[model samples]
Target: MSIELDHTIVPSYDKLASAKLLAELLGVPWSPTALGPFAPVFVNEGLTLDFIQTDEDFPVYHFCFRVSQQTFDDILGRIKRAGISYRSSVRGPVDMRINTDYGGNMIYWNEPDGHQWEMLTVSYARQSA
Candidate 1:
């Protein structure tokens, strides 16, 4: 059998609001559904981001999306319009800057839960040392 990522549970203080924010930023559809006590945000047909309401602080995670050029531009524009802080590097200065390090344009931002989100226009294979 082939392997694929089906879904993931994202812990959030306010699951609905967090899911909505992610959906809006990624230009995806999200709604409250009965799925094992999760506020699922459907990113695509087979992939779902399930947001679970939690009181305890969870470790922040990084999520990256490989998108088209147009989508990248649109998301970046939305990020700027929403006044979301972004950076070219992981721990770099906070700005609306994009990096072209991996042969593609990439930008990083964080969600309300401090989860790092990344969008890139191209996929660069890892280089050997």
Candidate 2:
């Protein structure tokens, strides 16, 4: 048997706007009310990000998406066009730079809710088969 991640709940100040922004940047499909009180962004056929509105304090999270080179370029272009700041290092300041130290392109950006979002071409954290 095989198990896969189906979906995750993302805490957001504005679920609609957050889900919409991520969907637009990733060029994915999303619905404001796909489910009860949650906005869903379809990352792919297998996975979905369900954004839920929250007012109480919540810890910021880090999300990493491994993408193809072309997809990375396209998403990065959209992020840039949206004027979102990005950095090469996860904890570094926004320098509008992409990191290639892992033999592939990678960048990190923070959403309005302070959740760190990452996109990379290669799986630096994956183990070799």
Candidate 3:
């Protein structure tokens, strides 16, 4: 049997809003409430992001999604149309640029809860391995 990531709990100040926003941006389905007070975003058939409400402080996490060039373009367009600021580099300023240094298009943006979301057309991590 092969191991795969099934789900993850994402801490959020407002679980519903956060999950909804990510779902809309990724063109995925999200449920306002799921088992045990979770606002779940169905990322795909195999993975789900369960947004949970939290008041305490938590470190922001970085999540990267590798997609085809067309999907990347579509997501980027939605980000732009929604007035979301994005940067080419992970820690770079929001120049609204896409990084091609990794042999593919990549961009990064932060959600309201400060979690970093990344989208790339190619898998640089896979290439290095």
Query: Backbone clashes per model, in order?
Result: 0, 0, 0
The C-alpha RMSD of each candidate to the native structure, in angstroms, is 2.2, 0.9, 1.1
lDDT of 2 by residue, 22-83 (tens): 99999999998674989999999999999999998999999999999999999999999999
Q: What is the TM-score of each candidate against the true structure?
A: 0.91, 0.97, 0.96
Model 1 lDDT per residue over 1-129, tens place: 778789999999999889998899889999877656898888888899899999998999888888999999998888888888899987788966899988779998988888898888876554435
TM-score-wise, the better of 1 and 3 is 3
Candidate 2, lDDT over the whole model: 0.95
Q: Write the per-residue lDDT of candidate 3 for residues 29-53, one digit (tens) a residue.
A: 9999577889999999999999999
Model 1 local distance difference test score: 0.87
Question: Which residue pairs in model 3 clash with each other?
Answer: none
Candidate 3: TM-score? 0.96
Candidate 1's C-alpha runs over 4 A off are 125-129
In model 3, what lDDT does residue 125 have? 86
Using lDDT as the yardstick, the better of models 1 and 2 is 2
For candidate 1, the 10 contiguous residues with the lowest summed lDDT are 120-129
Evaluated with lDDT, which candidate comes out highest?
2
